[model samples]
Target chain A: MAELLRTHPLEAWAAALAELPDEVRITPEPFVAMVDVRVPAAASEGLAVRGTPLPTAPNTWTPTADGRMVWLGPDEWLLTSTGTVPHLLEEELRDQLRPVGGTAVDVSAQRIGLRISGTRAREVLAKGCSIDLHPRAFPAGRSAQTTLGQAGVVLLSLGEEGFAVLVRSSFAGYLASWLLDAGLEYVPLG
Target chain B: MQLIACPWCGPREEVEFTYGGQAHVPYPDDPAALSDEQWAHYVFFRDNTKGRFAERWNHSAGCRRWFNAVRDTTSYRFQRVYRVDDPKPVTP
Candidate 1:
């Protein structure tokens, strides 16, 4: 049987990283097991992942033993973990939430992660993003589903000018191009 | 771009939202009992109020939840935003 290998979507864009200044960095994250969770708002209080409660507040995230749970909507969340197997997490979540009229779906392949951090990290992101990136307005621990250029992305603040941009796999190239082009202004001619 | 307040995600750019037309258009209790004209009206008619129009807006790109909003069609200012099940509030 032919071997099946999981590949990173931005593997081809690794060379583009050279154009960005050292102060601004964008690195593609390794494959993460992501599960889309849907539970009743009232019942969510009883749901826990490795003893870590899901974040009930909008646009917030709570850390788990392996990863974190990000709030997507009033009754929706994205559970991302790098340490666990995707199907196992999905099954575990499904069994736990089934009693509460909820569902869990394995969406690990739906999107890819990119970590952008450094002094000018916010500046590069601001070029194509419209949301106020000020620390007071969008402090660390906050996340927002907004647009970067024309691509829809989930921006997670990682403190001290660091952020995680999660975009659909299909739009990864466009976003990488946009970020690189935006970062070029910081690169010196020499 | 305008800022549309999502009831769940708070205010986000207007580009993240898609217009959902008039709000409070409930489905008929008895669809089979309705006359042809009433059925057509239910499917096609919507109030084009000039001021303080109550409408539905979907935060398509943001939280992806649908909410209701009351805005002045003339001034293009959103008076208030409420949840889908919440009762509409009086707007100026």
Candidate 2:
């Protein structure tokens, strides 16, 4: 059998990110294990991980030992973690949800993660995003599934002027290019 | 641009939502018993009210949930928004 290798969706954009100025930073997140979960409201307690319960409120996320659990809908959530194998995470999630009549599906490849942070991060996103990026509107831990540069993405607000974007693998390159282009104004002239 | 209030995700931009046509169109209880004309009416015909109208909308780019709203088509102002299962509010 030929050697199997995994590749990042934004591997080609490394140089573009490296060229960004200090005021504007955009970097592809490390490989993350993501799982889509659906559970009944009554049995949501079974979905806890490392003492962190699933966030039941709308458009919110809770930090866990590894990553975080983001509420996607009334009964749906997206569990993300770092440094864990995709299959292993899915298997464990499935086993944990089986008895609760819930479901866990591996969606690690469905999206590629990117972190955009800097003083101008919100401004870079404001170019294409329709949502209000003001600190008062989208504070830390708030997550929204919306469009960015015509590509669908799960956007998470991380602290001041930092954001985590999870976009479909097919649209990853497009979003990266859009981000870089939008951040051009912030890049210092050489 | 309009701001639509999603039942779960609060208010978001209109660009994030997709029109789902007239609301309160329940599925026929007995589809096999309907005449051709009746079936066509059920599937195609809809009220084009000039005033307040109840319509379905899908938050495609947000929560991805379908919800119903009452809006004045002429003014393009949303009166109220409610869940799919909730009863429609009286628009006076």
Candidate 3:
């Protein structure tokens, strides 16, 4: 299973980091991540899980006991785990929900989750996206799907100065490479 | 810019949606019995109300769902947003 899992080039790049220059600062903030879970429409059991009908169109965000769930589309949701996400929950969701309709493809391993924080995080995002990221408009705990440098991305504002970008697994290498090149001018924090 | 409230996604930028024209325009139950002029009226004629009007809009960018809203044609302010199957008051 370890060999089957694809290696992200950025992982190697991060592993290679050593001493830093006096003027340039770099730090690592790990454990921030994302996972793609696909459940077929049938599995929803006419519940309209994402945006079909049961829940009605225009997917809504409802608070749950554990965390918040954002309906991405029909039969799809992006679940934000409050703390560490256990594999058991994923397995349970599959067992309970998968039988009603389509297969659940766990693409959690496909994408990379990067946490960009600090005073200049918004400035870094502005270089790529067009939407207003100001606190008045975006605020914390808001997530939206939009284009970032020609790449479709899910932008989530986690804090006043923190954000998470969920990029496709295949594009992770390119996005990380691009961010590194662009972030060179900033106080680089990993 | 007209402010159109999506029934599902709530109010969003007009750029994220597509105007779907007037709502509540149902097809004639018996099209075979209607005259050509009546058929034309049913197909092409639109009320084009100057005041509060019910219209359809699709959240093209966000939820990709179609819903109904009551919007003022003059000020372009959306009065109310509701699902398609929900009952709406008839303008006498």
Candidate 4:
């Protein structure tokens, strides 16, 4: 008898997805997640450790060695990390950039990262999202926040045939189930 | 599938923007002193021109910044995009 790890709705989906048919494979990419932190306006200086200030907006972006951190709004930014969540880096951000009158909320547990890669990646994604994921429209390195099957999602174009989707943890199971059903049309790589 | 050049987010599809009505409407400094007609003008008056018009649009889905643009309403061609603080000069 193996000890079971406590799981949330999304975590359960991730586990169940692993047992998917051999043809339909679900690969869970490691580390990348969305951290929602609220910074107060008074202590808002030095948020962007690098990169130039946005021309018309009050935000900026700092490209990391492997990925980039994009300012989503006032006191909010999406830090793209590789492999594992940078706990020390996040702590540094909280200590260094705590808003004067705002608090930072760690919403990392509320989101899930799903990487859909393979020749049929685009075909699988198009079944849910309406955005033109064509290379001409959404080239590699580009990202957009849009609705996937009417579900809020952050879609990142990782490569010619690779994509990363960030969906709310609550909707992860539904999304994963939808993907598995739609992926049946393609030659599953799992 | 119209392409809109967001002053902050660069060129994106018009679907990413939310039309924010006319631009350059100054708020009344003294609302109590103004007449009813003046108040109505400030609240409802707008220049809905058909030719080249300066309008306000917020990149709601992108950078979420509001900027001004001179676009031809007839042809849907964007001639110039400028920051909100920049003066909207008359174009020939």
Candidate 5:
């Protein structure tokens, strides 16, 4: 059996972090596994394991005991969770959806996570992206994939004006730099 | 500063989407069986209507899904946005 190695992309950022200004804070959340699930709309099965169906609706995610099931399309979804066996989700979901001709693919290494929070969190995000970001419009459990800076990212609401933004590993550095610049005005000087 | 609605993600900024050319054009059943004139019509022609035109828009930055939308070309206002899987809306 081959053992896959996990890497830390935010190592330098974590090392330099000392204190965040009162207005906003950016935290790198590492080690979450992501899986993409797809089923043809005309398939016999509706993407389910046991009785729990993968979310069919758009822009919504359903929390399951295993992970969060995020709807990606009419017949597609992404399962995300934090654990060691994130790869197992691909196998497990494949077994469950296979009989119905659905597909499951592991995309854990393709993405990286960042958490942004504080009083100016929404304001900071609004600087480079446009997703409303208002609490009433996008409450918790709401997730969306949008462009941030020049990279494609998935934004999930963690409620209370906090968000978890997932960007591709290759673009992570650029986005982090972009975000720091966007937040410069909000961070108070010493 | 136009807002485009994605059937699933709701209304988002126009920048979040990529415009796909005219929608609802059916693919020729037998492309090899068509004349040059018919082939040209299939490939190069589009309505480009000033009033209402049905076309495709991708929530490229949002849901990453392709959907069909009907909008007024002059005003750039979407009258309806529907899922790709849904039947195309009847044009008025």
Candidate 6:
């Protein structure tokens, strides 16, 4: 068995999201787990780490049959998948990346993943985010890391009008409040 | 918020990036050999250009990486955005 060294990053915010407006909900995504990987784009070709290639195109993400790969920088990517053996996975990824002078390590606990989806989710996100959320510009499969509520966050389009807002655990509470406040105008009185 | 173009992430709101002060300031190759005054100059003083200036910015909210930008101080318009490794684009 591989040794583990991480705790759930979003545990503190789980209960808080449950109380968000029913019309525009902020739900803690299931802990799928994450790892940050880095490799030069030239060397990443034909190299599939955990069945996902390192994405080089800026602000884009690639989906695998089992997981997803997000391009972080010219040489950085974040790999995410569901697994209990973080140590083993990180070790294997590191070994594979070594030949190309790249590395992979765990960052699952560094961020909290939030799924903000509802009829009014887009409206709420537009309040604090500058990116044009219109379907044509940020279609599904597109991803961008930008400041939301003055906190750094990676915004990924999940589907039509639905989004995945990823933020460091420390900023989860602040972003959630911002989103809730932005959505207040739309929530029906109950 | 103003829009800042990132070489990688395209244009994002300014709040997503952190101002890294004056750019083109390199660390001394041998810090231990520098005199006290020289050290102080390197650490404390930076050109506050009134016109066009070169500076570093970290796309903290986007790519989470640092890069350089040349902008007109008076107009607050970015003249260029380039990678850290690339030569600083000439400022006019």
* Residue A166 C-alpha lDDT in model 3: 66
TM-score of chain A of each: 0.94, 0.92, 0.63, 0.67, 0.87, 0.86
| Number of clashing pairs per prediction, in order | 0, 0, 5, 3, 2, 1
Clashing pairs in 5: A145-B62, A146-B61
lDDT of 2 by residue, A1-190 (tens): 1121678888999898889997788889876788998889777854575367888888988778888799999889999877567788788888888888888898988988898998889889999988898889989999999899999999999987599999999999999899989998888777
- What local distance difference test score does each model get? 0.87, 0.87, 0.59, 0.66, 0.79, 0.80
Of all true interface contacts, what fraction is found in model 3? 0.22
lDDT of 5 by residue, A47-159 (tens): 46535666666777777764567777777777776653666867887898887788889998888888899889899888888778899988997888888888988888889
The sequence of per-residue lDDT tens digits that candidate 6 reaches over residues A1-190 is 2344545555665666666676687887666668899887678766777766566677888787656788788888888776546666688888988989998888877777888888778888888788998779988888998878778888888775488988888887788777767877766678
* Share of reference contacts found in each model: 0.91, 0.91, 0.22, 0.30, 0.87, 1.00
Across residues B51-82, which tens digit of lDDT does each residue of candidate 5 receive?
88889889887777889999888887899998
Candidate 1 residue A101 Cα shift, in angstroms, is 1.8
Interface CA RMSD of each prediction in angstroms:
0.8, 0.9, 3.6, 4.5, 1.5, 1.2
lDDT (tens digit, per residue) of candidate 2 on B1-92: 87888988888899889999999998999999999999999999999999899999999998888999998999999999999989989877
| 1 against 4, candidate with superior DockQ | 1
List where candidate 4 sits over 4 angstroms from the true fold.
Answer: A1-68, A73-76, A80-94, A98-105, A126-141, A147-149, A159-161, A169-178, A187-190
Say which candidate scores most in TM-score: 1
> TM-scores across all candidates?
0.96, 0.94, 0.54, 0.65, 0.87, 0.85
lDDT of 1 by residue, B1-92 (tens): 68888998888888889999999999999999999999999999999898899999999998989899999999899889999999989865
Off by over 4 Å in 6: A1-25, B28-36
Model 3 chain A: worst 10 consecutive residues (lDDT sum): A16-25
Cα lDDT for residue A103, candidate 5: 87
Candidate 4 matches the true fold with a TM-score of: 0.65
lDDT of 3 by residue, A1-190 (tens): 1123345546755642223232322233333222234556445435533333332232343334444455566556665443434354465555655656433334455445666666666776778776677877676666665556656566766655477776666676666666555566764467
